[model samples]
Target: MSELNALHDLLKGLGDEVVRSGERIVGRRNADWSGIPAVPPLAVLYPRTTREVSQALSICHAHNQPVAVQGGLSGLAGGGCTQAGDIALSLERMNTIEDIDEIAATMTVQAGVTLQTVQERAHEAGMMFPLDLGARGSCTIGGNLGSNAGGNRVIKYGMARAQVLDLEAVLADGRIVGGVRKMVKNNAGFDLRNLLIGSEGTLGVITRAVLQLQARPGSVATAWCGLADFDRVTALLRLTRNRLATGISAFEVMWPGYYEYVLANVDGLRAPLSARHGCYVLLESVGGDPARHQADFEKVLQDCLEAGIIEDAVVAASDSDAREFWNVRDAPTAFPILMPRLIAFDISFSIADMGRVSQDCVARLGARWPGSTVLVYGHLGDGNLHVIVDIVGASDETVLQVEAMVYGLVEEYAGSVSAEHGIGLKKRGVLGHTRSRADLEAMRAIKLALDPRDILNRGKIFPDELLTRRMND
Candidate 1:
């Protein structure tokens, strides 16, 4: 039979409502937040249950059909983007909170449930699901697990993988594996749960998860501090950690470019401090004792100010004030509106090397593209740094050149090419910059073992030549 005939036969059993093709799939053909060009898939599948997902995958697997898994599509990487002739398996209709055990401090939810929904539910139960990001309102739990996402509180609470106690996923050949186990310690065998969490759907499709929750903080203290330079910024971070200990939840840094750009372009965002410094830091601490936490938080900032670790600072007096401070840090959410053609990078370096690396990157990019604007900010407590370069009237070649420069620098510093975002289509070729050849080989071996047909998320993670070779083999 022809390929088209085989695909038709494979999808025949799946209901029409579950399978959308041609014009019906138009809305699914937009690029993810990464802004890569999108290709419409041959069909989009919305499986409501695990059994339906297995059935659809079984037929597709029998016919050697390729499938691309999609979640909320809020990813900064192009992992979820589909290509021509590929089936887009989306988890939209599978959104349902199965159970919440306040006593056990765990929530069982389907992969399609939004992060904000989980957080809100946890809050309603007087608990907290700590994995958070700007895309929480739209990004799904499955995507979070797939990418092993590290968000604002990674320094304290850790990544999405850390929050997940267990998960259930469907393998490439339509075999369902794993279970939503709420146990904290399970040494039964190899850790399949963690292995699938960061596999980015190449190995399996995450269906449901049991997430660990934290007790809700009784009080949160937020402050915006201006520092003379990166040295002062690091000093403040060290001091904050030393004094606040585990109470520190977020320690975000903003260079002048990022801090100034947001206040200028984004509406309703105002400067927290009247005076401008070399860089800015927005730090938050969460504690059970309200008055005591506030006093300790202020004391740390005061000590920093006295020691010249911070030049000027403003402690948020109300929730509205805290939101105002975070608005500046969260301004990147408006990048699509403010600057559509921006080249963004989410990278990491050693805590000690981050300042030097960031400075060198800004200077080098500035010298290379004199007119380009380079904005830098990130979770300094962790090593993640978000850099965005926007050049006016630049060509595609320019974008590639910029990537080469930035990634080359990342390689030079021995830093990660992608800190939180997974190596989707955008960073596939340069993945070797961070990972060694042996690492690549091991990853490829794992992929081949899990998806021998190379039918799951083809042309993702691995370099093109590697994937092409695997397919030919």
Candidate 2:
């Protein structure tokens, strides 16, 4: 029988978990959030348990059918997008909170569990799952692990990898490795969990995760500050790090254009401070004591103002006010509506180079794509800058040109092509810009060793042309 026929036969035994309907398996099932064209799979498999996942993979492995593992579908890159002849292995049916070890301060969750669910459950248990992002409502814990997501709380709790104590992933050949290991210290042997955490499903299929939870802070003080420039922003960041230290939860920065664009375009989002400054920084702190947290937050602002590090500042009077401040930052979701063709870049470089880099980028973008709007904003705390370019009526080639221009500049500045977002299909072609020859060789070696047939998440992380070229070189 044909591979598709054999695959269908194997999935038939798994019951309704397998979606054979061609139409249902197309569209979003084969698309990531990147707005790229979708490549529909032969079918989309919804595996409810690790055994089912392994069984599905076992059959696929035997048939030499490539598989694309999908979770929340909120990825910015095209990591989850399926290709022709490929089968999508979605963990949506695996959604569940297996256990909450309150004593150990860890939450064991299935791969398909939404981040918001994890956060809400942790809060109900008087704890906090600190891996938060704008897409937390839709993004899955497994997707977060695959991307090694670094969200708002990275300044304090670190990235998703840091938040994960251990995880269970099914190898390409259906080998289930790892389970719930809640201990923070495991010096026993090679860290396989770390390998799969950020491998972006190219290495293995993540089935479940054990996430480290922090004690829910009694107080979360947020402040919105208008800064003159990136220098002042860095100064304020240093002050908070020196004074508040681990208490600083988030330090997001937005350029004037980004601030103005959001305030003007996003309804119900009023500027907390005047948008006349060169930039703005939304600072937040969390601590055990409400009164002390607020006082410390206010004192830091007062010091920043006194030192001329900030032009103006407004501390959130209540939770509502804090949400309003974040609304302005998060309002970029209205980007699609605001601009016809928006090209985005998420890059990382030296924090000190941020001011010059963004300014240079904007200037260059304007010259290259005249009348295009460049809106810059991101988690400056960790050197991740998210740049959105408004190419209202640009062609496909124009978008590629914009990518080359921006990423070329990123490379010139010795910055990573992708910071938080993984090197999926969107950025795979440019992986060489950030990674070295040795790095690429190591990654290829790992991929070859783990999935020799390239049956797992093929057409991702490394472009086929580059892979061939590297091997020849």
Candidate 3:
């Protein structure tokens, strides 16, 4: 049968309302937040339930139709973008919080539920779902799982995968695997849940997940500190980790460029510190006692200030004050308007080497693009640093040049090219910079085993030739 005819038959079987074709699918074509050019797909499938999803995928699989899974469409990576001749499978309609077990400390939610929704619900239930990012209001649980997203609290709570107790996914051929098990430890066979969590939808489409929850802390302390240099930043981090231990929930670092840019570009944001410093660190601690924890938090900062480990510090006097501190950290939310042509990199390095690497990256980027604006900040405790280079009207070739320089440094320093963000189409070619040839082969083998026809998110995560050659064989 012709490819067009096969797609028509598949859509017919799924019914009219479940599928959107041609002009109706225009809105679904764009890449998620990466600013990559869009490719309109053949159609878009909106599956309202797991059965509907299975039915849709079954038909597409039979026709050898490629499917691209989409969640909230807030990803920085291009993993969710649909290509020509592909069908976009969006989980937006499957949003439902099925159950929340208070005693078990688990929340069972459909894949389409937003991270903000989950956080609000957990707060209402007097529990906490700790995986949080700047895009939490729009990013979905399924997207988070697909990317194994790490966010502000990863130093304490870990990544999105760490919070998932159980998961349910639909394989490429429309076979449903996994169940919503709430057990903390289950040593059952192959562990498919872990296999699919960070696969970026190349192996399977995540439909639902049972997430682990933690007791909401009764007291929270937040502070912003100014440090003279990277050494003092690391010193403060070490001191807090040793003194505060697990109570220290966040340790975010911002270089001068990032701090100054946000203050100048983003309106209604006030500087956290009175005087400018070489580096800034936003620290937070959560505990059971309000008065005692506040005293301890303040005392630690006081000691650092006295010992000259920190240049200055401001302990949040109230919740509003705390939000004001975070406002600066979350300034990237304004980038779409402030700097639309920004080239952002989410990479990781060892905690000891991160400062030097960040400095070297800024120097190299500045030397290459003298007129560019570079902003650097991230969760320093977790070794994830975000480096954003803004050059208006940069051509495609210029973007490639920027990526090469940044990724070259990543390879030289033995750093990961992608940290929390998955290696979507954007970073697929440079994936070998971090992973070995054997590693790539193993990953491709798994992809082939799960999706022999190369139908599920075909061009994501792996370089094009790796899978194309194997399928041709």
Candidate 4:
């Protein structure tokens, strides 16, 4: 077929080690992580260096071949999909740790480095990589920055983009742009790194990056506290932050229903404490001194109890115990395995409006689907909440109805439909609810000017109607 011949020639052009076509799996995985996997691509290009990436992209641009830039393929959004006739450019072979600037407290790494590898390697060198998540073992630095990922410690260390210093990416036209040097203070021009960080590889392909590091933590204190209501949780957060200062790194909240669901279904896990509380908070504090940190933690707990801000609290006494305390809140394996397919969403609202919006959303979900179970929880300190609506044995129409109800109410509350995950293929239709017309127009213009051929991850971020059908598609 002409398609095979064309793909073979493109691969041959890249070099013997760079390309592969037939009988090979390429493109991004589906949203469910399996169902409806993206249609196979014309070829998969695995470039090992910046120059190779440029040349391969240049060829694709010249041919007007739609290409998807993939890092770890761990993204939940379908940003990396490619149908027949399209191509995939993976940074898999580009893994490398170029340097770790100890003096500057920064590390420069290629985009393909696994996040967990960075964390462990940096820890071994007596530094800390604060950005972490359940998927760190598989996710890549570029993927993290692409989604502006916010994990457990986001309440303290900020998002992935905040922890980054600089980056190097190849634009759609095969032009390399951005700086790689570590700069803490640069007012010379626009903050270009921020633009590339959360773009989901739509505007360009991330090749290399420099990340900011923090001092190795000397002490850690974790606790699972029970709260009478969300108001108390907010008050508890304020009280702890006021007392502990910046030492508070993680503040995770869980609604009672969620905790109960996990305990009922998850094996090898028991409810550490009674599951009757209206709300539960998992708080962690990291500091430079162990003794003082532990004392301060207890004192804060006692103060909160006396002030009626907290009902009950159990502080972890050992490292193993601390992880045990967090497992209940962090693991979502049980939810998906035991419950029916749920419409899960991560929405961010101002801290002040969290209680009202969550309550209204829950009431609406219950009314819309009586059999559906609604659970709400999140990082209270950061104003980002995770909501799940379970539609057990529901029809496709029912599932869509629940989604409409949740997202529609979220917009009314002025909350983001996606707090950290990029729009990608999954949320393209709902993007208008989150971004304004002017915002999307500017984004489209930037995509056009930089990748005029529409060769870089085409038909993503923007809707499908915006583009004329690819001649070959």
TM-score of every model versus the real structure: 0.96, 0.95, 0.96, 0.95
* Candidate 3 lDDT (Cα, 0 to 1): 0.89
Q: Which consecutive 10 residues in model 4 have the weakest lDDT in total?
A: 27-36
lDDT (10s digit) by residue, model 3, range 1-473: 45587578767888778888877766544568766565887778888888888888888788888998999878877899877777889999889999999999999999999999999999999999999988898899999999999988999999988899999999988899998999999997999999999999999999999999999998999999999999999999899989874468999999999999999999899998889899999999998888889999999999999999999999999999999999999989898788878888999999999989989999999998898999999999999999999987899899999999999999999999999988878889999889999999999999988888888998889876686665547
How much RMSD separates candidate 2 from the native structure?
2.2
Top candidate, metric TM-score = 1
* Model 4 lDDT, full chain set: 0.81
Point out where model 3 deviates above 4 Å: 22-30
Candidate 3 vs candidate 4, TM-score winner: 3
Estimate the TM-score for candidate 4. 0.95
Query: What would the per-residue lDDT of candidate 4 be over residues 6-112, giving only the tens digit for each residue?
Result: 46556767765788766555333522232226877767888999888888877777666778788788776777666556777888788899999899999999989
Where does candidate 3 have its weakest 10-residue lDDT segment? 27-36
Candidates in order have lDDT scores of 0.89, 0.86, 0.89, 0.81
Task: Tell me the TM-score of model 3.
Answer: 0.96
Return the clash pairs for model 3, or none: none
Candidate 1 wrongly placed segments (more than 4 Å): 1-6
Give each model's clash number. Answer: 0, 0, 0, 0
lDDT winner between candidates 1 and 3: 3
Judging by lDDT, tell me the better candidate of 2 and 3: 3
